[model samples]
Target: MTPNAREMSESIHEQMPRLLTELAAVVGTTNVLTKPSQQQSYVQGALEAVTDATVAVVIPHSLVALWRVINICAAFDVIIIAQAANTGLTGAQLRMEIMTGR
Candidate 1:
């Protein structure tokens, strides 16, 4: 099983704000959604919808931003669930309530 944020490192709470800022900067603020309502649609599968568990749903419109996002998440030890048009039927992109950055 994939470990949640708590199981990872306690340092994530301290790094999340900076991580978010960098993410927004790389992808633009409008593309980095932090609200539950904005996050919901991104976590849905073809059959069921998962609860919003992500601190932010970052949408990178370019490969450069996507690469930087991966790097930023690694630097912060944050888990990533990559989504593509939310068209998966097997819940592959459905993120669990596995992170607690705050």
Candidate 2:
């Protein structure tokens, strides 16, 4: 059966430390933004909505890095939401939680 929200949250909480470390290794430590302060700009919406459920805001520097990031998230069963640099007409980024276990 599919894991419930609470179970998924707990599982992700347990795996986050390792996941962050591995993600940092793949994308470089500088590319991984874990703190809310550091990640705020990335997830900020056009209408002033801010999603605080992000685990980390990973900024991949290249196609290779992006590919690796996808693989890592897939391995951890994490969700991903790709956003353009300055586009959010539909508030897409404000929707689902990226890298969230749920």
Candidate 3:
């Protein structure tokens, strides 16, 4: 990985648990996914060739929840990939690979 990417990955790794906890509080524990299995759909797009790289998948049911999650991620400087329908062909959604949600 590039140096910047590596640094971001390390930072996310260090803050993952806390971030997940805060996200869960905002949208509930059921909406926050930390497992690879649960995060599969969020990371994988329309193309099978695109690798799954997200560390967490957060599902916020409302705009309020979405805003809260964004604020929490921003506070930690974690990159977030906003996804919907998984229709995009480009892998820009998973570029940073830290978090994805809808």
Best by lDDT: 2
lDDT of 2: 0.80
lDDT of 3 by residue, 1-102 (tens): 445766766767898889889999999999998788887777776556666567688999999999999999999877777877776743665553345322
Better of 2 and 3 by TM-score: 2
Ranking by lDDT: 2, 3, 1
- Candidate 1 overall lDDT versus native: 0.74
The residue pairs that clash in candidate 1, if any, are none
Residue-level lDDT for 33 in candidate 2: 93
Task: Please provide, for model 2 over 1-102, each residue's C-alpha lDDT reduced to its tens digit, 9 standing for 90 to 100.
Answer: 998888888998999999999999988899899888998777886666556557888999899989999999999988777877757632455534445535
For candidate 2, which ten residues in a row score worst on lDDT?
A: 89-98
lDDT of each: 0.74, 0.80, 0.77
lDDT (Cα, tens digit) per residue for candidate 1, span 1-102? 966556555567677789889999899899999988887777665568445466888999989889999999887867777766666543664444445432
Error of 3 at 8 (Å): 5.0
Top-TM-score candidate index: 2
Residue range with the least summed lDDT across 10 consecutive positions in model 1: 93-102
